[model samples]
Target chain A: MSVVSLRGVTKRYGDTRAVDDVSFDLHENRIHGLLGRNGAGKSTAMRMLTGQEVPTSGQVRVFGENPYENADVLSRVCFIKESQRYPDIFVARHALEAAAMVFPNWDQDFADRLVEEFRLPLKSRVRKLSRGQLSSVGVIIGLAARAPVTLFDEPYLGLDAVARQAFYDHLIADYAEHPRTIVLSTHLIDEVADIIEHVTVIDRGRIVMDDSSENLRSQAVTVSGPTKAVEQFSDGHEVLHREDLGGFTRVLVSGVPTGRDTASLQVEPVSLQQLVVRTTQFHDAALAGSGNGNGKGNGKGAWS
Target chain B: MDDARPLFQQIAEQIEDSIIDGSLPEESRAPSTNELAAFHRINPATAANGINQLVADGLLYKKRGVGMFVPAGAREKLVERRQEAFGRSYIAPLLAEARRLEMDAEDVKKMIDAWRDDQ
Candidate 1:
């Protein structure tokens, strides 16, 4: 059964529809990657899921109940975003302490360990911390909260490679001991490619793709060879991206290679990040061609 | 191993290599998926998938809630599978390269003898 479900969930701000008619389910004990380009509505969707924002015209359910202002359901969910705000007087440890007060399953020892790993200052005011330090605070809480459902929206804003790796390590370790639903919204698809079992790619306030990572990994492949062979193979499938170099052509297409003879073309699997970028680009073009595309242009680049 | 192959498949192959090489002997506890994930910096779920595939292949078995372990005869089974794969993965390419170099089977046999002696 789904622990969280969104049906036609739409959130609007003035004339802009940040999340438009989006719907998906976060299953129990599953790690789902909520992926998309900047301003592609990933954050909005997450906020909606965490009940920070209400859907304008659809249903959003958490534990069979609305999450917005629903303390019973909200208590079981943790939403950690990069831009998380703390009180003016609050320090790094203070934030964790406050979260511990609310979360029933908070593990103080785990929090303390994570605090050391992330090199977070215990007594430093939240606002005085470095960018990476601020990110660490959020990550520390998200992991230590042990919420039944946790949503992390680009929570590793300024963390270094080592710090990011430490987060992934701690996550996998803690998760093994205690199974829970984890939805990580990130642009670093390749980094987390092996981590996510399920993937959901959103673009321009719409869900472009959703499937098991295994299925997605096998379905899309980049084929390169003689121009004619590549074109012939790509003709019927949905081509995500294509590049040409003189007589050689490479096309990224979504479909299984089925034939008695496919020896002429060299096919390779597309990385999750590549697939998402290409797919969102294709979605972008389609939206542009349709002339009334709900382009958020929220300025969140894939890398950022 | 090809990096293009799925991450879980690569992980499974690594564990299989360990088993076939006698490092992970029969009846010994294999590392948990989370342990492998942390060590390799991959997702624990993907590591779990790879281990689960081994379980399905009969090379590994679960000790209830204890952990996954190599079942008896797993090494022999893997050796049999590897030998079956040898002809296609190694021999075929070797023969093709020999043919391109204009070396007959007898000539290749002599070369193998020379290589063995030098080694």
Candidate 2:
């Protein structure tokens, strides 16, 4: 079932169109990675999806209905953002209490355990909490709430590697027990590549790529070897990227080709991060070459 | 043992400890990915990386679409493999360094004896 659907969604700000005619359907019971570079209209699209911001044109359907100002839709959707504002007087526990009241499926026991695990000072004011602790608070609520549709917009921005790993662990564990539609929007693609089931790449306020993570990883290969040998092997292949390192050359090719003599070449699948970078690079070049310096890469619908 | 070993290596050691302590017997189902991830609040990718290492070492196996379970004789296999790795990756390096530092084999033998006696 489609948990969310967007049809010709366009968001404009004066002369700049943020999201332009982006159409897609997010299925239920899967984790989706909302990937994009800075100012890709990801946050804007998310705001529209959660009903925080209205679209200039097009329709957004959450569970087959409009989510804007809809109490039923709002309650079922949890948007955990990088900057979550709470009352100045609200303490760490107070925030948890507020979250508990908002989420019908809130588990107090799990929240208590998470608070202790994160070592958050419950008595400290929300504003006084460290950036890591603040992020932790949001993560704890997001996981414990177990909302059917959870959107996390760079929730671990300021967290260190260890703390980030902890969040990933908690998310995986909680998610295994309770599977839901999760949209994780962040630049840390390689970090969470394994857990994201579906992926959506947005660039210039448009959806460029949307597919299963498994297929994305398996479809692209990084071929590297001697410069001449690599070039020869990459012939007739869709090269997403190419770089020369002295006598050696590396190319990220789309889809592995069979019947290719690769015994002398080093061929391996591209990592999720590499794939994203190469894809964005390819888009940038195509944009520059089209003489539409002002164009947002074909004005959306770039994902083919 | 280096105190600052990688997190995944540390996790692997912890799982080994559970086997040594009889907490997780051979052929038992290991903790699910979610259990490890949620309990550690780790990125599921990192936790999976650690578990994949264990799986590579024959300590764990997946049951098709089901969760991972401990392989038969996994405890014994891990114990043997880890003992070999310790000798090569740690003990050999320590002995080599000790030799370079002018510590005699007899001295090393004496130190080992003393450590064992103390234990």
Full-model lDDT for every candidate = 0.87, 0.81
Model 1, position B72, has a per-residue lDDT of 96
Whole-structure CA lDDT of model 2 = 0.81
- Poorest stretch of ten by lDDT in candidate 1 chain A: A295-304
Model 1 misplaced regions, further than 4 Å: A260-264, A295-304, B93-118
- Candidate 2: regions farther than 4 A off: A293-304, B1-119
| Candidate no. 2 TM-score | 0.73
CAPRI-wise, candidate 2 is incorrect
**Each prediction's TM-score against the native?**
0.92, 0.73
Question: Which 10-residue window in model 1 chain B sums to the lowest lDDT?
Answer: B1-10
- TM-score of chain A for each candidate? 0.96, 0.94
TM-score of chain B of 2: 0.71
**DockQ of candidate 2 (2 decimals):** 0.15
Docking class of 1: medium
Index of the highest-lDDT prediction: 1
Report i-RMS for every model.
2.2, 9.0
